[model samples]
Target chain A: MSQVNWRTINVDALDPDSALNFDMSTLTPAVTPVSASEVQGLAGQIRQLLRGGDHEGALRGALESVPYGADEKGKEIHLHTVIEILQSIRQSEMSPLLSRIYQSEGGSELLDVLMKYLYKGMSHTTPTGGAKQMAPQATGFSQIHPLRTGDGGGQAMSVFLSWHEKLVEIAGPGSIVRVMCDRRTV
Target chain B: MAQPEIHHLFHRPIADHSFSSDRQTLAVARDNLIEIYGKSGQKFALQDELRGHDKTVTGVDIAPNSGRIVTCSQDRNAYVWEPSSSGWKPTLVLLRINRAATCVRWCPSESKFAVGSGARVIAVCYFEEENDWWVSKHLKKPIRSTITSVAWHPNSVLLAAGSTDGHARVFSSFIKGVDERPAPSVWGERLPFNTVCGEYLNSTAGWVHGCEFSPSGDALAFVSHDSSITVVYPTGPDMEPKAVLSVATQLLPFMGLIWTSENEIIAAGYDCAAYRLRGDEQGWQLAGSVESAGRPGMDSHREESALNMFKQMDLKGKVQDDTKLKTVHQNTITTIRSYAGSPERVRQFSTSGVDGRVVIWSV
Candidate 1:
């Protein structure tokens, strides 16, 4: 089984701009910009990897791409990704966008990857760590800044920043950075 | 698809009629008197006026196998009445309650019956052969809040009570000497839901107005102050909530809720409208809407207008109190219940409101 070419999986190819159009106000413990993009890209890659017959690699890729951030949008994206993956696996469908991959023998493998990553990410990034702890005092703001109490508290923050850099590294800093900067106002 | 044929066995202008277990007789509480009507809608002629209840009787229930009838009144007394050759008369009266009695129902198969009072306490009375009428077990705790409605589990072991505090509590009776366990007392355990299941907060401040357990005993349907209905399952030891369905802005508080089947629910509200909801739908569909024809105030208003036209003919000072008449239909709805015999039939049910006339609807 061939591994997914992470570099070729551009942020534009995944259509991050359109995907972010949904109202993110209701998202709990907001998500970070980089983390959101990575999640979007991972969704696309998982679709391609499943279509390409690299089930093991797709699973491994999903496991590696964990959501890390306190932002409500980020947490919502994480939850949506997990739900999407589970639903796809349950219905034996490929990711939402790439229908061509759905017809291939690699579809099952792609589903496996989405499932692996979703459960792994969920356990690692349970909502209890962040805004949940400060929820009483922060009121509505707690959803935007989920603060982890213990040691590894900085892990999600660093992962979020790195995830954004990876998108800029793969899909031209000019296009990706401009989009990320615009999302702050949205 | 063909519509189910509904047979209307009887129709009367009686205001508030409650059914007995056999569905053969109905006990109608009107004005200050309680009348029993046969299935054919004929007055049983056994008219017994319960005088001790200084106010209108709000609810009545009949025991399953026994001939005893329990009636609750605004006067704050739950009276047990038994039928004799002369007429139906109140034999025992339990007094000194905090609020008016709102609902009363017999335990499915037990010798006991339950009463929900305005005070939020549910009193369980067990029948004793030696005492003649039922007596209160007086379990250490009265149900914790002001109960608006009470339903007995079909099998008779559990009682589901809905309160004014927006919570539903399930009380179960345990065997007294089945094991080394202590004898089961009157008041059972209580369970409260963390959040009301089907309510959509319009202004973030609302309480549950009504709730009923389904006939199958598998689900509990509740209506919230926000005009939304919630269906919950009370099967497991944990009492897990399975689904929450909200009906937006259409209905308001003080509505009636009843199950048409295991999955379908029907509700009516103060808007003079009724709606039916299936499990798969996002909200309730308007089933029917009707204005009461005999609204007491409207009748009195018409009478006053007619009297003025006659140039105040010489007669006794029988002018009705306009304020008292106006208070009759404060809420559009007066009373509601499932069709007497068939619990699953959806097309027909019974209701009475400010009109003071009971109307039965089909389709």
Candidate 2:
């Protein structure tokens, strides 16, 4: 050809800025990846604590072993254990339990972990188990009834929202922002 | 506390600023041009402007000793300005990257400078005597995202970089000819080029916005987008750190931070105020805001009557003047540099912000 038509060529198409071109695996810190089995082991211990009526111990246990590097299944298991611990606490004991945890050593960090789980639990749309069934009702009505149970999703959402409200009262709005901006999966 | 010395520059963001070693010349990256201000009497007057880049100037630094002004911009280029009898002359550096350069810093030795870019690379550039111009050696491995900021170790061989990938890394930028063999330290001994000395990720995986080595170079501290500052103290080479303290704050995320002393850090960002964090290896906490609690414009003593409303509306074209923030900066402070005193004990520091003001604060 005498001359190539440069104007006809698309620049972006020729040099695409595709995400696949960049390898992000090496960018993370060299923390040992928390395996799924390790998460299971921690869940078992948390369950034992929960069965013994040690809700605080179970919550602490769950919060302490947050699998930040583990897969989705591990995170889901930890979230379930944490929800169980939160649900067992009496409504009147919520503030007292929070204050107690907040005062303990490394308590703020534990609360931060719990805040992460609360956010995870709230964003979870697909229900896990069939312990409680929720009717398809208006969003406003569902929020009005925190204890009312129907389906797993709605009740879990209400629980998460209730804890979030109380969490803000104690931890302030910064906790939510931290959880949102934090990129660690768990 | 003495009142902060404030210079209201033109109404534009100062992305980066540097003061000459003698504290007479001030170079600030104002939008697309580098505006040079000379200290005269008590105030800084506009002296000259260096214009070369076609895009926003992202970073600027004047070598403390050499007085060479190095500037990088979004146009994917960097310039080293040298002062001659005629004026300042610019020499374009060969930063063969395809993306915008975000930040730059002159090494303590003033022999080499590091330019962090959006292309996931840090170009450590130095002058090549053979070529008689500046050339760059790219640190391309292990960086996955835009490099937000870079800091040079006191030794001038080890470089600390903060990136959007949420990891703050220490790399040995030991150019064989440009840098001498640094003495053995906690970081490492045999530091060839591109040696990964240390990498610390933000606990919450927030994008690292700022990174700085301690005055002693034994510790590294970085501020992330999660509104937390994490300090890393390495024990030895190829070993776990002695302590990695992450201090979460309730205020907004800090865009820049500087180690005032070994145990103290001053950080400022979207909160429009400088906060002092104090602690040692024991623990770190948000000590307090550097700005005193109650200032003149902090109180909202507006008369809620129609007369006052009409007066305010007539004077300012608004019913209420809620625009002024209680803080001195009134906008996000982007960069905080050690202005005076040694790194061991910074007696004074300067902060530049989007509000087009450079404030010199005494510690």
DockQ of each model against the real complex? 0.01, 0.38
Report the C-alpha displacement of residue A13, candidate 2, in angstroms: 14
TM-score of chain B of 1: 0.68
Q: Tens-digit lDDT track for model 2 on B1-363?
A: 667888998899999999999999999999899999999998999999999999999999999998999999999999999999988999999999999999999999999999999998999999999999999999977787899999989999999999998889999999988888999999999999999999888667778999999999999999988788999999998999999999877677899999989999999888888989998887789888888754444445554689888988899899988877878897999999998999999988999999999999987
Model 2 alpha-carbon drift over 4 Å, by segment: A1-55, A67-74, A77-81, A84-96, A125-159, A172-174, B40-42, B293-321
Q: What is the TM-score of each candidate against the true structure?
A: 0.49, 0.83
Chain A TM-scores, all candidates?
Answer: 0.28, 0.73
Question: lDDT of each model, Cα atoms only?
Answer: 0.49, 0.85
Model 1, B64-174: lDDT tens digits are 577788887777777888777776667665544667777777776656677777654566666555756556543213233467677766655566666544455555643
Model 2: docking quality category: acceptable
In model 2, state the lDDT of residue A111: 80
